[model samples]
Target chain A: MADVNRGSRPLSPHLQVYRLQIPMTTSILARITGNGLIVGSLVFVWWLVAAAAGPDYYAFVNGIVTSWLGLLVLAGSLWALWYHSLAGLRHLLWDSGHGLELATAERLGLAVVIGSVAATVVTLALLAWA
Target chain B: MEHLTDRKRAEGRGSARSGTLHHIAMMISAGALVILVPLFLIVVVPVIGAAHAEVAAHFARPFPALVAALTIVVAMHHFRGGVEMMIQDYWQGMTRKLAILAMILLSYGTAAAGLYAIARLAL
Candidate 1:
């Protein structure tokens, strides 16, 4: 006879039991970056709204955003945006029935991380020059 | 033992039968973002530390204003869906419902505010 309380059974091993790998790290990064982008989005929106509000308010917000701490946050957000975008592209590839093999998947994961960093650097450099 | 086909067993069960819709929504937004995001970056990045007037004048251009508006709408919609899935995975009961509600509101509110601001700049 099946136990009526089978619903209470313990679930399988979770994060604590697993060894981290490139794919796992990249997947976790996808979520982190995706959620993390809200900060940058909020700040950018505030800047826009403030600009629309008045020059004083816009100056205040702009001053803060141009500060060192704010620049750090912006840099982090830039990297996160790039990482999430690339990871999303990787997912689209998987959805199309490719890159499922272990080696290819891992390689793609590595590419996402490295590519995002490179993209961020190039963006920042271009922004500086412009 | 109760008998049912595998397909029959799979039917009518899963996140209120909207899993595919959610996935398609994410994919569509992702596709849109692939285009809009880079365009937005190109539009906004140059004026990051520019003076108030310059920043406003920059966004006032048709290209920049349009790109920013579209990116805000689509990205927020995508964010809402992604956060809903995250909440579903980690939360339950009323907390999950409330969290989802909060995220949805946040996403739309951000989008509305952003669009309004852009509209002001463009005008």
Candidate 2:
């Protein structure tokens, strides 16, 4: 018979009990940003579909996405994209048997955080220039 | 079951029959995105708030349309994989199956829509 009392088993202390660390925080951010990009992806799809539908529809979506609220989402997504990309590179490095030490992992985590913000700012600057 | 040794039974059953195929696919797609994403942003970002005609004309060009299409397809595929893992982590039983199914549909559906739209604009 299956263990019916499994639900009552003592559970280990979990996420809330531990103080946060850079690698842990960065790993969590990676999952968050990866999933969050879906929103931005859907919005961009809507923009394309609207454009395909008609000029008027395109104008409507274009207007909304260009609006301040939409811009905010875009900016967030831009940052998320950069962060996720850098996080992914870190994973790839780990996969190759590199950067597994705790100190190095923490440093990579910091780099992911700071680098993403810097990349977002530069991209925004370039967009403005263009 | 006792006839087989542990190593023999587990040899081909590491997390599924496909083994590391999913991981390999994700790595390949991630590498692809590293290229496709920057090219895509360069193509699409500048025309953010442009008028309809200008925006349409810009994307209607072959290079921009192609970049957008590639990014849409690759990104959605990657999203599908990532979301599947998330659902598996947090959901269970029928809910997990259904959610994964729904997301698979959504991911491919969006990819198809984007491709169709890009095709229309380009052609």
Candidate 3:
């Protein structure tokens, strides 16, 4: 049987204690954005190795990239880049002692997500036309 | 009061150095991205059209190669610092902390080897 009545223990000063603030929110968002960057880097590494191998390998990767699924991954990478870039800017501002207020932080966090999507769309459109 | 003053000074120095290193690493990472993204678009994208020789030649350019090298180095440094912080926060025992440190060292070492290979090829 499960111990349903187990008492809660004292916890460390984690995210739960205070109201959401910009610095904490930005830090959380940056971590999530880092996952995207990591995945994108792995894809890039695969592309690099494929390019270095030979035409056959290159063609294989090229085919995948030109496909719908590949395009989706490429789009994701672009979104990751923009998201991480905006998050980076947020960190830069925090380091400079600005944007510490709750309203500003929340506004910037929303902007980062929306702006990343916008940037990704623009990049994909340009790539498609070019 | 005297002891408290000494402790405050030590904390200040420690934080100041940490902040400076982080700022420098972030700036380098940002600058490298500026160079790398355009290089990817300009030189590398077209290489997808050309033969392997042409691609090799393009990478062999000193500027592009240098940019690649810098990007790799700065990226590894940034990753190492972030991993170290994560370890400090989550790892409890000394054994776990040491293990985390060892992992970080190995990661940086491997990255260094890979960057060296890329640089040598480019040069």
Best by DockQ: 1
lDDT (tens digit, per residue) of candidate 1 on B57-92? 988888988988899999999999999999999998
Candidate 2 lDDT for residue A116: 99
iRMS, model 3 (angstroms) = 11.5
Q: Provide the RMSD of all predictions against the true structure, rounded to 1 decimal.
A: 3.7, 3.9, 7.6
Which TM-score value belongs to model 3?
A: 0.67
Ranking by lDDT: 1, 2, 3
Q: Which candidate model has the greater TM-score, 2 or 3?
A: 2
lDDT of 2 by residue, A1-130 (tens): 2223435888899998999999999999999999899889988888888888888888889889989999999999999999999999999899999999999999999999999999999999988888
The DockQ value obtained for model 1 is 0.45
Ranking by DockQ: 1, 2, 3
List model 3 lDDT by residue over B1-123, tens digit each: 333544454574444357677657766676566566555544444443345566557667877556555655565566566555566556767866796788577556746664654554475
Better of 1 and 2 by TM-score: 1
lDDT of each: 0.91, 0.89, 0.63
Clashing pairs in 3: none
Error of 2 at A103 (Å): 1.0
